[model samples]
Target: MIKSYFIQNKSKDLKSFKAMLMWIIIFTFTTILSFSQETPYYQLPKNRKQNHEMIVMPNLDAFTITYFLSASAGIRKPFVQQNGISPSAASFEAPANGFWEIALGQNRNDNWIYEFGITKSNNRLKTSFLELSRTPLVFTNEIEQYYAPFRIKKKILTLDKVSRNAFLNIGLGVSYLIKSNNKPIEEGKITFGQRPIPEPRDYTSLNFRIASSNQPIAFELLTEVRGKVSERLEISVFGKAFFRNNKYLNNQFSFTYVDGSSKEFGNYEKPISILFGLQAKFNSPKYYQYKSRVE
Candidate 1:
């Protein structure tokens, strides 16, 4: 009877241990689920709370480089053509040229844009002269000059009817003659029976001061219409008018021909030039920002 009582107590102890093990498992699972709800690995969109909005900062400073092809036109009298008695002014005409520029720009609250840049242009000037009667001299001269311009432009007017980014600007700049192909008269002179008709270089005065400090200063009026192609690429069409002081010579050159013929052959003034061009501008994507909205 004592043995039987011990067996019954042992069975009761085993049942109690199974019940305790089940309770411990349930408690552990509950604690883990509670912690997971508080701190999750990733948050879902539906679980996000209200009153949290993302903000994007504006791009205040950006850099751009432009490659453009422009055509220039002006009635600039840079040389003189003379026959026997009457002297006339010969105008120089320019063809289309290419320019490369690098600029840094500042955007002010999407209202105004300020730009400063350095540009270089390769230009060709053409003019022809004909003395069809007396000396029978006929010739055409083509001259080349390289210009390096440092400029700053400020926005003056915005055309809201045309586009959001269309604007007019006024520019102040200075340009230096980096190099020129001006040859001496002795190489291309023509002799007519003891009178030597010198080349254009002999009649045109040379500028001894060709440095950057002695560059020509100018003001420009320009209008630009820009279109965005992508986040980093933009295309623009622009028209500019440049009003500059004398770009080359300051005084005229007077030369006496072989038959006691004298004429003034140089003009110290530069005319107003107009330019029309298309440009492509590039910028970095880091200068722009994108925002996400969560409601």
Candidate 2:
């Protein structure tokens, strides 16, 4: 009887072990199948288009240095030394600036641009105008002056509705003004092929004069209307203003006679003025990585 009882217990235990092992295998297979089935968060409607693609730009990209050279020609249109009458008259600006830009970012509207340019920085625009207008000089000559302005600027952008072809950028900047008179031409004579005339340097005209006093600072504002006119070519109109330092820029030339000698006098005066010009921007080709995933 004892041997029969032991045999029955052993058989019962073995059957239970096999049954448990079978259930475990079935459970594992069911769990794996459920996980393997694709389950998206949501499904699109049936009427949607077959292809939906998006383009992404290099929004988070390293900065690059931008090399640019701008040629601008400016004149002192408002100097009164030779206005033909009265003591003086106020003048406006025809300042042309040649700019070289360096940038840390991709030169987008969100980043600032540092500009160092080649300019006439001609402080003697008035004196030069006086000589040209009064000296009766009839010779062909070139007066090359040197000047430079250093500035930091950023762009504010806007969009247009018509054709959606144009964009506007307004810039705000400040600069340090630099002047040079290393070569002051006084009563210089030039000869045309057949005609020779007196182009006096007239440096003696001013009594209280510093050839080129360092006029070092200013605030500026500028705007650009930009658009793509052709393939890979962009054009823009730029307008700017140097609004500060108004008190230091008087065009009035004072004349005084002492001991039977007439003398012209001026201070360290500059012109606070407006500027307008055109700009061309080149757009290089942009490359992007296309990625695809099935939902």
Candidate 3:
């Protein structure tokens, strides 16, 4: 009886040990599979299988410094009138403007990009001849002019990865005009003592105040596609728009005659613009990647 009892105890111990070993094996296999499934976020190539690492590209914590040259043409229609003049009745309408912009900045690992930049635009109104009929006589006049503004812009956005080399961008920013120059205009002529003389003198100043006390802040949405076209060349295209209030442009103007007489002019509404441009990035891909990591 004693021998039988000892044998039964030994058998029970063996069964318990086997069960524990089985459980250990199962747990070890599960842990290995889980770790294998989650590769390092940056280790996978663009064509890798669908996994966490492949779904979200590693955050490149690096600053990307880019400078681009862009030109854009847009129409500006005034919404408000000034100095007893309606926009439709003005000397010119919906003039064309060309702009140049430069930007410098960095991108965070979270896909947020912050940039400060500047843009300059030169615009001109078409020259035209007009005749004013007064009770005493009729006078002929010609309007010719150009206007330009320098603006400082600050921008912030997040890049939503759409593909290996593409992203959808949403941004917001503010623009402030540093300076503006207007075209010169000649008033009508004055005839005194049977002699015709140039009257009011041609004045050279900005026709409208493009910059106001209130800063022009706007939101931007764009889709950017970037890829390496060559060993040192990367290209991207962006479509952008800006929306803002016209109140900031509320301009008050006063024109004074040589005789010390002046006329006060009210404000005119300014139009917004939608712009598109292409950018080329020149640098070593590894440099960019490393810079991104540092950013």
TM-score, each model? 0.46, 0.43, 0.41
- The most accurate candidate by lDDT is 1
**Which candidate has the highest TM-score of all?**
1
Write one digit per residue (lDDT tens) for candidate 1, span 1-295. Answer: 9999999999999999999999999999999998898654324323433212111222223232333322233222232222222243334344455555556555443344555555555434443234423443323233355555555556666655443445555555656556566533312333333327654433332111111113445556666666556535667677777665543323233444434555644323244666666666564432323333433
lDDT of each: 0.46, 0.43, 0.43
Q: Rank the candidates by lDDT, best first.
A: 1, 2, 3
lDDT per residue as tens, model 2, 1-295: 9999999999999999999999999999999877666322112222322212112122322222333433444333222123223233323332333333321213333235455654453333333233324453221112234434555545445465544446766666656545433433233223222225423322223222223323466666777676667424666677777554433433333333322344343332335566666655554432223333433
lDDT of 2 at 94: 25
The Cα RMSD in angstroms, rounded to one decimal, for candidate 1 relative to the true structure is 14.5
- Which is the winner by lDDT between candidate 1 and candidate 3? 1
